[model samples]
Target: MRGLLTVCSAVLVTVLTVAGPVPAAKAAEPGGGDIGEALRHVPGLTVVDEAPAPDGYRFFRLTFTQPADHRDPDAGTFEQRFTLLHKDFSAPTVAYTSGYNVSAAPNRSEPTRIVGGNQLSMEYRYFTPSRPRQENWADQLTIWQAAADEHRAVQAFRALYPGKWLATGGSKGGMTATYFRRFFPHDVDGTIPYVAPNDVIDEIDSYNRFLSRVGDDPGCRTALKAIQRDTLKRRDEFGGLATADAAKKGYTFTTVGSLDKSLEIAVIDAYFAFWQYQKQSDCATVPKAGAPAAEVYAWFEKVESLTTYADQALAPYVPYYYQAAVQLGSPEAYDGYLRDLLRYPGADVPESFVPKSIERPPFDHFAMPDIDFWVRTQGRRLLFVYGSNDPWGAEPFRLGPGSRDSYRYFVPGGNHGANVAQLPPDEAAAATATIRRWAGLPPAGPEVTARSAPAGFPDFDADPIMTARPRL
Candidate 1:
């Protein structure tokens, strides 16, 4: 998924309780039939705290105790954190499956907003706030295990929210939702994976192919390369500038070797960022090879952060790199054109970024391929949204003959931020109608103004899964 930092940032609307008169206090116990008590009743579930929610919605921060290794109940247990946005008991429930950590704040997903239903926004297992006690990254963080964690959470919550259920997520979360549906076919009535990729391996070259022919303007592609070549041509100058800048900021680069190597990787990533996040209009800002040193350096930083490949920035995402190197395939760097200008040629592979402390087993080459095959053929009620221009959209999940009630829609010029609401009116209507129908809602969905990420969490650079590979 593109932006890991873009968690739901709806201003915490502080309130006393669920949007209703407080019921007489009965002993907080299961089977009491009260929704609040129903939440307390689910086995392995604990109420962490209540958070401010959108008006008419009650938000509860929750933790569900899950086995470290689902196959062995006796192995160990970890408390996986999640949030419940309650609207009504009879309303449909949207399982907002997260590909990474669940934010403490309550935010509405497109589906949840449009459907006006309850939401179960869950943090993926092995992520922050949900990690196991003993570090068993290699054995405990499989795709199947994460799906199992979601399944267990969903099963427990289904008891309280007996209405229809729909699963949805964007970027990596979208992939998580897909895996959830793949493993537990009937867990949710339908799934919408927005701008998710189905890369077949740890290091795929599809991105290189996509970037070569990405935008409508041939000039924009040429301009992107021009800036990359310009940055490297002045590596000595920019490298010194970056080094001093890093020192001033107190940034460290031990994780990715040295500041110079991080600079090289950041230069390579600028091209990916241009297409992954920037639009055609932004191409006007591309600096020429002969542009002033400050002008060129600033442009590079603007397109892609200089600290992107640094150890300090990468510490939060080591788990993502481990997963990518181990199972979830990731896009390799678009470094073919920059190889001649590159000082560190092979630093862009997925494995380079993983920490040395965590042991990575050989990539389970079949895991993702099997998932791709299953989602293509037998997956049902699956709706996929992609930005036509987003590089991650390059390896989108394809619907096959055996797939039933499935759809894949692309927002014409959408990037990683693409969504059903962004699709053309007809396409958006069709996609929303399908989701509404599957979730047992009325044919006409409500008008929802698209919500942006809360300030400080930009979707493009903050992506958790496919951030630029670190230099080794």
Candidate 2:
């Protein structure tokens, strides 16, 4: 799921303990019954304003522990949660900042529950920047930094909430987590940032190079190409179980097989920059203003299935054919096969190879693999978790220059958001049992199993399961 998180810059904020009266305490949230009654007894929890969310259900931000920003006074200020009173409590905080994943109605599950029983709060913030981020990506950075500073969200939990802990988020949110971990190492305890692509500029530039190299690597490339050919041969005879894009993402395609020969040339134009097509090279495809919409539509229809599995990978099958074709064909043939760069909405109109929101060009080839930069920082604590098969979870993360260690875990055979499915239902429950438990709408759901790391695949790039596990 796209993150219900964004870095809102223009929407200014500074969460002071702004109630009319600095209440010694507030009432427990209503409607939870036994669970609600049980929550009422949780020490330090005080019901604040009942904020309205979608579906007419209101979510009250309860206070467990009072929090304070350890950052410079001028740096910013954020009222802390009320749960930081425990003796061994590290009082961890999970800050989420996603690249493009934003959901107004967030899923009930959160990413941090892996370290079940730890003390912390989930800072459910959102930031959705306008398109054409190229113009304002820098300005947005300040906005992101300010948001973290103003909230002092990370610091409050670490200092106030008690117990060793960690902070984490996925994709864009993961990027935000990575940034926070690095920029304010002292504020957060530990960090598990997933699917965060740093080295943004280098990654984008490397996309073209990746394609070229894949084209050169005969064996691996050919493996994918052969799959593409076989799929093409069988596509007409049998109805497909998936879309063209899905096929590409999963390494499958119809005849003419993999576009390996042509893709290397085309992606250059497709991902060069925002709104602008490539120059110097003629591979960028665009539609003539007068072209019929049907013509363009048909192009998408033909290759649409190719992108179905984009989140997973470039269809390994077609690229397989691409490799074989390149190896078997003459240099002239290979060059001749390069895809044309004409009116690309190639049939691409509202859609194209890689979107601008992706921030960087495709870097499938020159993998700058994720490595753990787990630097135990001054005041950091962590609780990491993941499903064994989760691509995002498998990636390595950097704990920044001075970050702390993590309590990481992995669930075997689990897909993307599998951690929540474990014994402990969601984030609040985990927060509730925290040493100095916070008060809230009766910790929603059951105690969920914490997120964990996979056991094998040691060579995998970012999967920190191996890196953060107890080595003893």
Candidate 3:
């Protein structure tokens, strides 16, 4: 949810295909007996192509014709794209419930790598190749419908692979995985979701609180606010800079009209993105009061550029905005700080974010709230990972005292990229043990290594952020 650009960069332009050895032509259709037979027999499913993947695994691209609306069979069908990086039929499997289109790139799931198992990454319906005709968006985009699509994939794969199965995802993908387990509890043995937020409106309130309390020193928080305030206060100068930059780059802010409005949105996003991605050292770059307007503008660009929300940036994510407005609730941008300076008061509204060309369906607020309750009460064998400084961590699933099987690990000062291996030594070992036990595998070699921070950030352990929640 935080880095749509990073996620979209991995998408492939080609249609689905499987690249592997061809089986003998058969007169009769095969039944669900073996992996190959199951692929050939699964209704509305086809193996387009297959080829050799890294680590002695077979890579496959598949097309699954799923009903537009799972609750109603009469709603028709659409092609859902998925990929399988298969190691062995008997090895443990990790299924990635992608929040957006499943990229055709190599598998990067830590859980899959840590367990040394097969990986199945499925694209969410209504995204790119998996999307239906534009007219069908209203009926096709729903949490239950997406969950149903995953259930179909799991059912097909279970028949092919007899080893233990695990599900995991990050950000909205994590939320997608949680919804899958909620709908079909027996689908996977365990799930590990990273930085997944359960936002029920008022997301800005939590974000505001997070920004106010995040850094080790209060000066860092004050400095961030100063940059935001200065950018807005000098909109004429900064807006001109942004407008010139956009024109030079051939970028257009079609969703929010004028250059001034674009600057405002950029400023708002800069605050969120700064805390969402920046490291502690980056805080030193925040310009002082007397700094040139150009210097401040440069800092804004460094944190989050206005081009990120341009029409080009918004094109691939139209369906995501539609989903967020519908069942998947999104937070309203916090405008209280700059309320007086704002020109387009409605710019931060959930529906306002969707382009005028796309029709926005009425929002169903109850969908996520219902999901939050189900995961808390009945969900089991689930692990959640979050970054303490990350704003999205504000609305995590509420795990009460009785929720024994569910656990949450917060990486102190960690941003959205936080992972289980980044947890403290003792905590990481405990988490690894739980996952190994759940996958029915013995602890062996090839330990999971901690992830390095993105470019410009300090090394992960240089200034470690502690975990927020205790071990369960």
Candidate 4:
């Protein structure tokens, strides 16, 4: 396994120097204009509000109307909400693309915090207010269309924030950032995708291997698998507990068809979720052998709740599932170990989880192959972060030794939330030094501070609303 040194500071700097010449910046277009003047004439763009932000900064909330399907621009459009955190027109800019609903409020991204530059946070298409009034799942939810949407935003903003621009996001958002770069190579100067995966199969086999051995101790692994087996063996008793709990929480699993199926899926998801979010220390919470069925179920609930698969929890993410079924493949449940105990052995099938209202188009298996080739061969000025134990890290982009101006960093024993900031001081210094040099800034120090997150910011790791297990 590649260790933390792969992304350590010195290695990154060396890669940058040895990699081919940094791509030259595109020539600035004629008629340079301010942000407000630039937006006034752009089609489908309107600056709705501007207000003071933290750290003496200011921001603007804008709505961008983009075609539902980029291939057919005249077909229809949807309003994608975005926020612009202003520093200076001449300062570096970070384009933060989110993979889910764009929060109505303003926020700062990790890149912006490190670079101390302006930020543009764009919401993903077909999510929340970004969704078209008339939903068209067939042609509208493809990653290509979403990338085109971000391309438009970058094009519009380039005329305003004429300085350096970088793109970034976390998890699915991180995946979106890389897709944006792949589809629109010249849209931004660089990209930093955190905990992103390039899933190549409908049922990613790597996750199964990852779950087989994650924590430091073998007993913890044995205990976790035993708990899963016990839960499935006593699913009837556990199902009743789950059903009553779902009622109290007002969650329904109609998307999966029945409460029993929901409970089974929850049990299947627990093993993955445990390692995905929890630290090695958390393995102590796994129930021991012969633990009461209710206690085992409660531990399951604590680690991965049945409510995660509820109708309301899954409603906003229907578009994601559609994309997964079509082009963005998802991980299949690792049920091989517990196959004997599972009542519905096929519950982990990708299509089985998708809602009936949405059609599952034929997956273009070649899509990921093409993307992988592009990212591995031609990708430049890109940095990747992944946790050593993150199951999704199993399929990270393979950055060859000969690859240039690109680097991948693995947090030793880190989970999905790993990043440069979370690295040890020496490693963080090394990684940030590379980022600072890339962003055309001076050496890093106390001057860089992350802006406060908006109120009610959803915790992606633990919050059920934000937890959608992507195979990637």
The numbered model that scores best in lDDT is 1
Best of the two (2, 3) by TM-score: 3
Question: 1 or 4: which has the higher TM-score?
Answer: 1
User: After TM-score superposition, what is the CA distance of residue 265 in candidate 1 from its true location, in Å?
Assistant: 1.1
Across 155-204, the per-residue lDDT of candidate 3 in tens digits comes to 66675676799998877788889888866678799988888888754333
Q: Residues 1-472, candidate 2, lDDT per residue (tens digit)? A: 0011111111112322221112222232232223223335544455444434334222334443321222223222232222111112222333443322222222222433333223233332212221221222222123233335323534333323333444555543454555455444454445555434333222123323333332223443343333333333333321233343345455432322334312322222222121111121212233332344444323323323223323233322222122112211101112212233222223211112222342322222211111122222332444444443333332334345454333444444433333333423434345323311221113343433333322221211233321211100
TM-score of each: 0.87, 0.38, 0.83, 0.86
Task: Name the top TM-score candidate.
Answer: 1
lDDT of 4 by residue, 47-135 (tens): 89876566546678889777776666456777889878776667788988658866545466768778878888888887787888777
Query: Would you list the C-alpha lDDT of every candidate in the order shown?
Result: 0.75, 0.31, 0.69, 0.72
lDDT of 4: 0.72
- What TM-score quantifies how close candidate 2 is to the native fold? 0.38
Write one digit per residue (lDDT tens) for candidate 1, span 278-324.
Answer: 77788899987788988887887767876677777787677778888
Q: What is candidate 1's CA lDDT for residue 308?
A: 77
Better of 1 and 3 by lDDT: 1
Candidate 3, clashing residue pairs?
A: 17-49, 18-48, 18-49, 18-50, 19-49, 19-50, 19-51, 20-50, 412-465
Ranking the candidates on TM-score from highest down gives: 1, 4, 3, 2
